[model samples]
Target: MTAFDGIGGAYAENLPVIMISGSPNTNDAGAFHLLHHTLGTHDFKYQIEMARKVTCAAVAIDRASDAPRLIDHAIRSALLASKPAYIEIPTNLAAAPCAPPGPISAVLAPERSDPDSLAAAIDVAVSFLGKKLKPMLLAGSKLRAAKAEKAFLELAEATGYAVAVMPGSKSFFPEQHPQYIGVYWGDVSTKAANNLVDWSDGLLCAGTVFTDYSTVGWTADPKGARIFTADMDHISVTGHDFSRVLLADFLSGLAQKIKYNDATMVEYSRFRPNPTLQPAAEPEAALRRGEVARQVQSTLTPNSTLFVETGDSWFNGVQMDLPDGARFEIEMQWGHIGWSVPSCFGYAVGAPNRKTIVMVGDGSFQVTVQEVSQMVRLHLPILIILMNNHGYTIEVEIHDGAYNNIKNWDYAALIETFNAGEGHGKGYRANNGRELADAIAKAAANTRGPTLIECTLDRDDCSKELMSWGHWVGAANARPAAAI
Candidate 1:
């Protein structure tokens, strides 16, 4: 495959991309002529050489002892560069004698915040927070990656700021928390949600990437307002230029310096849920799907790990009421459509004690349904919930009737076709609310092996909240410059 294709594209999106390549040693290059694609190739650093053009940094390691240091350096370089990095490890060196383990140290520690600079930044943030009628806290994946969830939540609570979690940080905060304003991306972000972002006078962004999807391509501007950004690396007031750069280790230090007051808390306490005013008579099909989501959520155990596929299935699935100990996972960075099924398999293998539940649309499930065979082979007790709406529902919403549909498949029968019917796994189907409840119950009770619950839903029975958001976004985009 060409560079920038396959997983390489992940790096192109300004996200961290690390490539590890196995190559022959420099001295053995002569004998490993066949490994080279072209003749007269003396240097055996093809991978590293090629990677240098595409990656921010590239290095070749000939000794096993240098692998850890090289890897750490590559990762640090990639994060700082905000681009991809590559490392080529010679096959011979991989098996070489290990070096003596030294005292471990953080390769990339947070830069110390200057006392004066820190005071100025905190003063600006505190002044805005104190003055703003409504302030918000937007938590991003960086907080989760840095294990700063408690600090984030504490800050949000202390400031009485309504918290809106970025899509990638779904489980970073408890959804049931009164201060939580719901997900800030995908289908969950409605006009009301956008309004909340619009209404805020100040935004305190903690470890978040204020990217397109998260802000709906800057539709929700934090302009005319102060923006306080805190991360391991840098902070920007308006996110235009770098205002201050701090090492990650200084988050606790920064948090301690900022004082929380009752006035900030008072404004946040006044925040209320702005639910969509639905019609008295909801469509029969929409009602059915809602009930199905409700049923599945109710049946899930506290320790369940839910993996939601990208699309309408994800939109509907996250609306479900998750239990206290339940955790959710999705490929937010890549937004890969078929990630759920295979990712669920990996999660099941990695976490054997927890029950892994995968919620996927029929369209996305077909992408990597073959992994179900592997699941059966491993006897991993995973549950797959197929929302069989018979098409790519989200795409249809974005581009109505524009070849977004897909051919139907016998979703439940696929499990039987794989012979995972009894001891290994079982398959079940549901069409309505009652049937969905039964199917989910059966799947939960089947402790021996994996289970596939295919819920046949009407393609028209999509999420109203999602539809409204899409319509608003489209309308906003279509409006003329001055009018908007």
Candidate 2:
């Protein structure tokens, strides 16, 4: 028997995967009837039984005529459970005729969130909103997938709430909007953003998977604070009952139902970010890489897309100023180290016409470096900025004494290694601000394939603000009971 661990164990939380397997039919005379060592033993029910442990639902279909209904039930189970499911198809039935398409009937599941529970949650949320001087909204990816962006924006605008988007959900709400705060997660997140989470009287999560990475390991507060969550599955809250579970579809509809008033809008405007955060500094040679990233922001056309990898490069990548229609993507859920390359491949494929750029650190670049071949083969007009600091800089901050170091790579040479020749694509190296600017300009001009800019910077150069914020947050988390 073959065991399949669906993608949901760690990687895919909300995604549904259906696994189908083939088994030899017992009715066939030529099939061996061996119970222990031979093929098709134990009636093939054990495979389905084993699959049941990992899957939300499982079934075995022996007859050819029942294949359609069995497959339909498996799919329905997956959607309803919002998790992985499986089905075992007999080898003999594999070649059988499938039933004609039937009238599609929507599977109606019971209301996940009770009306009274929703009312109670709304009451608690409203009470907290009335009391708090400054409250904020932390929007997640599920909300974007459910198409609740507009409604979420309206809610934020109506309630005098500042918005802090999670890394994966960056650009869900326009980054340039006055009410928008920066991305949260990792050491790069702003101190003010973490403060907003800690001090807020109410923390409302809509369509967000409240995982450890997103909440920074529950370091943010939840107790006594009003918490209202809307998700397709039943998520346990400290004080709430199971009745608080909400269907993703219904939550979106409810968001649209609420009306916004002018007075509410005026109140929301009060929380808009102060303009002092934006600063101008001379482009120092040591800070050339980060400065170039900021400069690239200005070159972006409307609706340009940016994808950032995890590591030192992310430190500067998040600081890039974006235009109104620009979008940014980062892996906040898994925090997988080498995701930028493949993720950029996926993004470029999905949005072919849009300008896509990936920012990666030297250490992260090597993990999935081969993805450059994919970009070259497809002729994607993507730009890659390699921040070659020679090692893992973020790890150094996390554990000051530990050696989480890495060997260096001649990053620009990888373009040729991947077979992207001069006419197809070119690689450039930058050691200072002027060279970095020239490299970026050349990349912007190249419309054929991807370009890689390897920027050499001193290892000592790091984001001081980020380091300070990390220390403050860590110390706050370690404070004594009296401090709380």
Candidate 3:
């Protein structure tokens, strides 16, 4: 009950999770026997109702014979919707006999992609591109979620157009691809990358959610460009909308017909890395935010995975290169603070064989600090680089509000405190760049258990990209009311 509110968006955004809950027996209903976890009402549907808001489907398994069908329906709905589902099994039915699940492909309903819609969408996109002098592909995270990464890459290669990724979809597309440009986050984007994208004559965005965060508060000026966008179920090209078109089907069709735009690729300098601007002073001269980013970048390896918190980490992590096979996870759409802590915990468990690293801020860390104990208990060797920026620096950068200032905690001591003399984990506090580097090296070598390295930084330490994004988003959030 206490954690229900936290997963609303998680379910809505199609996060695949199964929550099996135990409830009172259906026979016990209307007996006036109050259940301990109930809402003190005769009706037992209260909890189910609460869960229905977030989950795609909720089922109560009342009969043992019907259990398999109900379970199958719940699972199918969850997969199709890409969301969470609820299944309530009474304590009495816990040992119920059910039909065995045969082949999974036969159990789930087939997802049909309309042939007409797919072909039309592809034709429209191809025609739109053929008329433009410059066309590019803006890829998003949904490409990975919808299992269309291969199709998307094929389309990019087939079209021969320059490719860019939205901030939210970072690492979904291979950054090392020859035609790959850089992240396109509007005003917060790298100057060359943003210009190439915004100035394009045609833009085909696939599996993208153009939320405020991705567009830098809707300041991206791609309206002038002919737009063709595709998601899981629908594709919109210019003004025409095609329904019942799956993202993979559309991309696959586009890949078959997308004309080569070699001229555009040549003009944009394809295969070249984004231009890097040198800082005036050496990175070690002062303990600056950019230097911190550089250190984090240097720490990444081909086998490592990075889980960045929803704040300055987004900007800093973006600047780091993701070697092939390396994964980067961030909650951009939800933008929930402290999400990366538990998220990293789950990630570590799911990918136990891979090296995991989490970059979290002091304020965000406080919200999900308890998860560290579980990581230690499970012996997950994740390196936690906690940024000690005093408070919510991202919020301060956006709106200098007093509420953004939060109470700071002794973050590094938490590992030992949670360990409780168990020696299950290690912790360290670093106040300077040298100390930070040393602590990182220690974390890299320590494989005994999870490690926490608290890096003390200036209160205002933030990336330039964050400052620009914050300003734009702040302005949008503070829109004038009723035109005054």
Candidate 4:
């Protein structure tokens, strides 16, 4: 039940996760015995039936002979949908004998688009690409789920248009790329990003998702007829649907059919990094949000993996550029606070060889702080840089009210209580820029166990971009009543 409750976001994002569980014995399933986990019912299919609502496929392995085929079907369905799949092995059949696995093949074969439909969509898209004076590429987070990241990047390289990622796709593409602009979320976008995208005569959005939060509460500019969209199951141009297409195949085909141009390269060059803009002298007294962000960026290594929490951290963390070979994860569509803490625990377990760093806010950290004990128990090298702003800073920025305030916790001290005064783990509190830098360095060097660094900041100090985004979203949330 707990797992089911947390799976909807993964399903909506089309993330692939396989869940296997042990079920009641098939013999007892229909007998007088009432299971400990199930609702009082003779039918054992209720749990699986409920799971089917969220998962792409669900199956109960009642017979040993049927396990192989059923498991294969669930895996293939999950891959095809890029969503989760559930499999249950009855306790009586837990040791079921199955044939050895077969050689690897295309489990979910690529479904080709109709030739005429594909050609027409591509022609319309190509016409827009070639004729338009300003064309832009907006990549979405689904490109990562579809395993089409490389193909999408190739497409961006081939078509020399400025590329911007959606808010949900902050780290999907390399931010420091030559043609990369910034995130494009309509009104929530940076001045340069919104301007370029709004002025674009043609837009190519691949694997894009547009929700109220991502679109500034549904106040984003509507797409015109010059937009090309490709998803996992569909490809379309100007609302003309091209069915049964795969994103990777569509990108490959489009790459071959188009003549590459670099008209937008001039605009892209204007957004390139300017070293002179960086602060010449570090603030030795007070620690600001921007300074904390810069410090986090300075500590990142090529092998480090970063998880940014949902809050003002989104705006600050997105400012950091990912180094080569580093991995980044953020939950934008779900936007659930405190998810990173536990998720980073799982990440540490999966990749023990690499260091895992988490950027979490004080309010959100309170929700999932217990996960830190698991890291300490396993001696995982997880560095938690906590932003102690005394309340839900994101909410205060969005809709300032008395309800948004929270009781402050001595976050760094709690680490000692969790650790039970053991020197196996460490905790540090930093209230100023110099102390914050020292704490970061100490945490980086301490690899024996998980270390927690609580950096205190003014409650009102948040990234300017977050404030800008919050204002727009707040206004949208409280829009004037519509006429009947």
C-alpha lDDT score of every prediction, in listed order? 0.67, 0.64, 0.81, 0.79
Candidate 2 local lDDT, 286-403, one digit each (tens): 4455476666666677658888777555556566657888887776565667778877886799899899988887878878888888888888878998878777666555445435
Tens-digit lDDT string for candidate 3 (361-446): 99999988999999988888899988888889889877898898888888888788888877578899876677778888888787
Task: Please identify which of the two predictions, 1 or 4, would achieve the higher TM-score against the true structure.
Answer: 4
**Can you give the TM-score per candidate against the true fold?**
0.78, 0.74, 0.93, 0.90
Regions of candidate 2 where Cα sits further than 4 Å from its true position: 1-97, 100-136, 183-191, 194-197, 208-219, 232-287, 400-403, 420-423, 465-484
What is the C-alpha lDDT profile of model 1 across 134-195, one tens digit per residue?
A: 67777777775555777676666666567777766777777767667677664456323445
Which pairs in model 1 have colliding backbones? 110-247, 110-248, 111-247
**What is candidate 1's CA lDDT for residue 336?**
68
Instruction: Give per-residue lDDT, candidate 3, residue 146.
Output: 75
Of the pair 2 and 3, which is ahead by lDDT? 3
lDDT (tens digit, per residue) of candidate 4 on 1-484: 8787556667876777888988888779556688788888877787898889889999988889888788888888888888999999988788877776554454566446677766766676676688888787888878887777787778888888888888777767776677778778775574257667766778888889887778876766547786778887678776577777777767767777777776666865666445433352254667777777777888788788888898988877766677766778788877878889998999899899887989999999998888898887788879898999889988987899998888999888887777776646778988777888888888878887888988889988888777877888888888899999
For candidate 1, the TM-score is: 0.78
Model 4 scores a TM of: 0.90
Task: List the candidate numbers ranked by lDDT, top first.
Answer: 3, 4, 1, 2
Give the Å shift of residue 258 in candidate 2.
6.2
Superior candidate under lDDT, 2 versus 4? 4
Estimate the overall C-alpha local distance difference test score of candidate 1.
0.67
TM-score of 2: 0.74
